[model samples]
Target: MLLAVGLAVGLALLLWARRRCPRGAGSWGLVLRHWLARRWLARAAGWQRRRLEQACKDGPRSQELLLLEGAGTPAPDAATFRERHPLTRHSADGTEPPPSPRPPLGLWALLRSCCAASSPLQGSVLYLDVLARAYPEALSPRGTARFSWARGCSLPAAAWPLPSLYCAPEAVGAAPSRAAALYVQLLLALQERALRVLEAGLLSELYDALATLRASWEGLAQDLASGGLSPHLELPQGLRHQLEGLLAPDAARAAELRAECARGWDVIARRLWPRLQVVVVAEPGSEQLYWEALQESACQGLPLYSPFYSAAGVLLGLNLWPEQPEPHYLLCPGWAFCEFLPVEPPGAEGPPDTVPLADVREGQEYELVLTAQAGLSRCRVGEVLTVAGFHYRCPLVGPVRRLSQTLSVRGEGVPEDRFYRSLRRAVAMWPGARLVDYVCAESSLMGASSGACAPHYQVFVELQGVRDLSEAQRYKLDQCLQEDFPVYKSFRLKGSIGPLRLHLVAAGAFRELRDAVGTRGPMARVLRDHRPLHFIQSRVLS
Candidate 1:
């Protein structure tokens, strides 16, 4: 009798809770899974913090003492570890580290945090769909989510209703068009409530998506009103079927988009996804140019959020407060033993001294170093980061650039940031022009075909709102470069360097090049050796 009564009461409570829950919000099992995942993450983070503290405490001891004396193992410390293990750059160190054992919870936490927003429940279009399954409320009809890459993602059945598109790796080329179609389809199906654009390619890809939307809005509006997929979008059969189902005849929404489309490209994102709250991007780095372009164009009025920073199988840091404008990452305490080597002058010899994370000062730039258990010794990731400020005890780092990608034609050795600034200034001088994508190559790579007698820089740019450039307009970039570097100016004046060559390509040239090259990473803005034939052949403006 007692058992029967308990079962009856539990069943009644469960049914009542189900009735009260929002439609598609998920069952009690999902709530339990979310709770477990969150708990595991907290524990993993706590373990790492404790390990870091212990390493510091035991760091002063001799290596001999640490190895021989079981009772006196030295505490892990960055400075002492640096003294023993020399720094290794990834390019120079070609061998992989032996698999190092990881605490189960720590490994799980690292995997869970990949492309995850600092707060998953509320971040639309920036949150990963796999995690969204653990909390169905994140996939509720009120909002949507986006992935940085769907290549490795295994989207469970639960994410289907989230109103976001996940293209299989095979369909990467058609993604922009498919994404545009899905955006319009959702806009029609959900009406005004479909005001979220979920995407995760950082700002550059987002800019491309907006451009595609502008090009296809009229055709998409027609498709939505007719309850069918746009013929131009080459999508998988299954995905096409799923998308077609949402294309119910929504004439009113179609008309709404058509009217908004007339307002211009600058107003497209805002007019379409007016309720979009936050923009999530990939690991923050030298993306300020892309961010500014986005701000001036489609992503106007949207708050930006960068949740956590990780790369090449390492969990680097987390942004505890993404509400702030400038993206800052708080270094993970337990992931790896951390150190920062101060950035030296261009010709500085040997490795400079390294400082522990605690010693990093505000505004100082440093290259990150890590000593971890994986047969990995002290490895310099070659990524330079600036200490932006701090969140409590941890340093808040903003990425500057990769050490290897700097341009060095005529030994000017201009860093990525400087070149980006010069290009940005040149773009600003041109009226009605917006930069889409650009790549720089030394004239030596292209030889005489570059149209320069001496060594120079061959720049290819894709621009919007500009067709042909007068010689004077193209010369502005050379002038800006000289202002940034006296060395380049001297070489040009001495006839040792040829005039900078600029080529304008068709709008989608770089996008096609990216697909052709394979998306292991974004096309290098500066190419050191070979120039892709796709880029050379696609030049439209003489």
Candidate 2:
């Protein structure tokens, strides 16, 4: 009896040791950590696979993703992305569904229907959708009871919405595999790095990896949410809270993480922010107060960061404004002109003859000059004699009228001389007609007779006494346009320019200009360029 009991005790001890040590048990903590790490890796892999499959099935146009994959390249750049996926060419009306929704469908059906869908890229979209769907527990809204449950599990109550996910051809073009192979590889690399950090028990590295993955996954979730690509998935609150907790112990680290996250969010926001029709600015010397007021007023409750001065610098660059100080020229960084304008001392002003910059106008010549200084500063101002007084307070700023640059169409930058010459020629072609106001736009008139799917430049002319011109005369005017601008002629052949449509406005059109403000005052007079053409004015030709 004593021998049997001793044998039983020995077996129990052996079992306990095996369970604790496993195959590679350097320590108790290492054993537990390894187990948990393995579990997480398996979970991540499963999640990734499911998401990828779903994205392929439900995305706008499967062909885009397929074509990208077939090209076996990295994702294209933004410009190239737009070139390959011309949203304008695809109908937004959604009047019809693709012929073959499935992959194995007939070639003609795929070409005619699938190719007609909204976006071509499918893998990223599918991945996001699947992530959202599979992780509902992580993404659900919280009630008081639910919040308690989440807290018990260390989950967050709120989840950030999915970001806008756009896959550019260039991004894919650079990849070894045209599809999301690189993305998957990146994910694997990140996971491997995270595992290494976990194995070494490097808390800082682990936290950093976790934060990065969290940001990436969150971005993917946001993209899916905004794209409306997948109905099953939502932002994962539980995961977000877990990520938040990872940085809770270190305040400084948390702040840095937050800043990085904010930047990522901004990238998503810039892509998804509802475009504003008008951007206004406050007048010179008042920008600081205006921006402060703006922050205090409408944006106080939001999670937005204070506008930085660098943001202002970028905007100034965009407007072709000089960065250096000049007499009479106020360095105003209003909310309209920049996302953030840091407070700085106004440098010595420009030349004594330097004029207070006048507001922008249509048909006026403007120069974007670079300053001769240690810093290459550029400013966008009206040409020497093209002074037009301020019209109205800018929508972005309360009372600033900054100059606006029209959008560029084609690789050929908008040459001021060529644009003005085109206008002059058009006016000269008409014996008695005087040009009153004009706005030119670079857009794709897709679905038009021209099968070309690229951007085209179109000029909107508001001429005096154009109401009497017959349809035949309108045709003649279009012909004259072809003769006047060689670019226009080339654009016509490329199917970039459409028939020169004339809109004769009531005399009040110019008088009503006072209602519009800022850089927009100039932009309103002339339609800024865009990829898909948007309507500029409500006034229609008779």
Candidate 3:
């Protein structure tokens, strides 16, 4: 049959391709697939850029054509399109409102197309040896061909396809004991696999995962010796049996791991997996506090790498990590049209001064503006970035902070950088303390919960050591704040602003609070409202 002939030809071609690769080079199929994917991605990126540019040019005319191409009436031209649909804010409406203008391209459609162009080769190429060991069959031509059609799930573009244990935050929050049991299972499996690198959505998740391991190791060892999951875990029947298999009664190994854990979790990764190379996280510059905590907590001399930079569902830049002390995002070509707006003063408002991506200069800070086919003419994502240098024509940028993260009380307007610097200095002064995570809120929203009469700043911090601070330790933060900002100091002197109240929460309390509110994604450092602050108020250390 024709099908049989086709299969034979394909097999012959694959074998010939394998022979072409150098001797002892495992398999040529992976290389072929990778190179093909790379080519496909390049083509897709070019097409997407062209489509986005055409959509921007056509403007409202594009939408009219899409909706009424076969209708008798002709679509509006570019001039008519601009005259009829002037650029306006979402809130711009009269008593008798006109229909809101819709983007020529659908946001979700554009996002899907953008995601299609995402190449995972960068993140996975470094782990090819590990992957080959983990999945030899997948490296073969036949297996690769079969897997292309096998459907069940899809991975994020940057994620490596490897054995992973997934735990939903909601599930963990709902059943802590069950989650601990699952973590024990994961650890045992990881011990068998010798997992050397860990990757997660954010650095905080990585820290939380290890913290769970630290808390559950004793129970994990006991379960391993007994060759059973804990009875108290109350896991589902199918999962319980599966987990029991991982606990294969390795008493000596269990004891060794338990002993290593008992020594301390400071170098746990090194002790457990001596080859631990790096911990990779996705969010880089925005989550510096979590990054610091993760570094201290990981403690295996593990370097962290963030492979890509994304904002508001758009991929903007890719990191050239390890080359710089702090990773700078090199703007991704053909992904989206990027612009930078000079960051205006907090209250100063009018049309922003925006510079095209090509004109950006080094060491200057600007608010990032992106134009994509993402259901808007243009979107200023509130991300502030400083251009580090250039990679040819593309500017390398690092995140400063978000414009929305700026905090103001009585028009004092404290910028995020100043607050971060003050907090860093203050934390250094606190004896035996290191900041795990922190959030800030203006006292105006807190009402009596702030325990202050005048407007002030409320800083809630979770610390690794030092359960409670002395009066002097608590005052250090306020002192740092005043030293950093003269306007805040003036307000404090005039009694217009009260002292900054520092609240300490238990180590994992903030994670719990965020999960409880179903905010598993990145949350703003400065909360606009009091609800989340009030939610965590009960858990604050007295």
Candidate 4:
């Protein structure tokens, strides 16, 4: 009789709790899901660790030895490394002691070690009909509780919804569209290095890329303005307000930017993925994928999504959450067989050149040494990172800019990242007018009375299309810029500067310039950080 009573009470309690608690939601759900994922992650980490350890122990006999040998560079731990002038605080020698001589890792191997998971083997098709199996009511109204899992993670308003062309609900780039493809092409171009942009052979490719990007933009604009498009996405309320003052046709609600050729969600999804497609169904000779998609995108009028990762990754600095990975890039002190050096003010002997992760404090900057794995040991790759904080013995760093990317005109320093924000402000001022991309150069202006010349800022812009600007528009842009760069303001006030000048380049000018330089997209992107692009002048059809 006692057992029967206990069983009855337990059943009753369970039923009552189910009724009171939200289905598939509440605090319990979050914990349960995380527990499941962490279990898998732990298993994966163990698998990786075991393989790495085996390779370390086996030396020449390891099956992975071939992979290690391909490193083809001087061992970072070799005595020669010790012979180099010592500059690190981490060690009177420099960095962590070289790993047990088992073997060094190549770049690809190092990248793999850093990755959380290998590429998925499964096909890319979303097959919603099939996915609905376990949740037969997934699309039904009652399934609202099914997606409560979304509330678990959040992104800041700035990155919550991307400015992408609308992505398919189930999968990224399942079907090819010019709008979607153009974004990838643009991204590839953005990553290019400056030297590659000036190369002689890559010129035609650059022209083709720029033209396609423009055409795709025009076509996408038309589609967004059309009513009742399912895939079309709108900017979140917060981001919309931020860009409204600069965006044209200025529609805050009701697909306003698309209405004029403008281009997210409460919970952001990775929509820029190309599914299994390199970019929505790779074609023959995708070796030229960037160029191919760009050409197609120029002709298609489809609406597309923005590159979610690129923009979101850059803005990760806005992250306010605790425990989530802070905005950062990694430094492989040993992985690349590299070294890091301290950056000190000029004329004063700097402190210890490099500090170990455990000893590194916040606010100090360091220069990265790369390509030692590529056999260039003495090279300092120009990457500068500021220590934001520490993750245990590992330092969490925020990237400033490559040394080559910083600009100084009359000793008013402007950093690439900061200048980018100022440009966004200028974009906001001319709603309906788009600032596609721009170039800045130091220009010489003759003084009117004294016949003396001075250096001033001359900005050449390639807008979405040619549009006339009123005096107010120009001054408004200029004023917004002064607020953005404090040092620039002081220079202007001190009469050490000439008036700012803006030049509107002709349509297809950038395309012509890109082609003439024969630079690949990746190399071209490198040019973006550099203080100026002399190649850009060839395309200045104005």
| Candidate 3 stretches greater than 4 Å from native | 1-157, 160-185, 223-231, 234-252, 344-351, 464-467
- What's each prediction's TM-score? 0.73, 0.25, 0.69, 0.44
lDDT of model 1 at position 515: 43
Taken over the whole model, the C-alpha lDDT of each candidate is 0.58, 0.30, 0.57, 0.36
Ranking by lDDT: 1, 3, 4, 2
Report how far residue 65 has shifted in candidate 4, in Å. 16
Candidate numbers, best TM-score first, in rank order: 1, 3, 4, 2
CA RMSD of each candidate after superposition: 7.1, 24.6, 9.3, 17.1
| TM-score attained by model 4 | 0.44
Query: Ten residues in a row with the worst lDDT in model 3?
Result: 143-152
Error of 2 at 63 (Å): 54
Candidate 3 per-residue lDDT, tens place, 346-425, comes to 56878675676667889888887655444433456767899998765667888887666778887787877678888989
lDDT tens digits, residue span 1-542, model 2? 99999999866755544476522112344334333333333444355445433542433232234334432222342224334431111112212121111232222332333212121112112222333343322111110011001011221111111110111111211222211222222222221111110110111111222333344554433322233212232224443333223221223323343454455433321122122111112112212322233233322322211111111112221111122121112112111111111112225354221111222333332332212111222222221222222222110112122223233455434343345455656567666776655555544432353235555555555566556556665565556656765665687677765555554555434323321211111123234333212333444354
| Best prediction by TM-score | 1
**Model 4 lowest lDDT segment of ten:** 141-150
Predicted candidate 1 versus true structure: per-residue lDDT over 1-542, tens digit per residue: 99999999877766655564433224554433334444444454454444444543443232223333321223354345456666676652212222122222233444454223221211221223323332333333324444332232222211222222222222232344434433533334234334343445445555555655677778767875677866666667776776565446778777877888888878466677665655666664655667777788777787676665654335566665655787687665434556789988767898688887777889999988765443345678777899998655567788888766677767877777788789989999999998877887777667656663778887888898989788999999999999989888898899888788888888788766654443333446777545364454566566
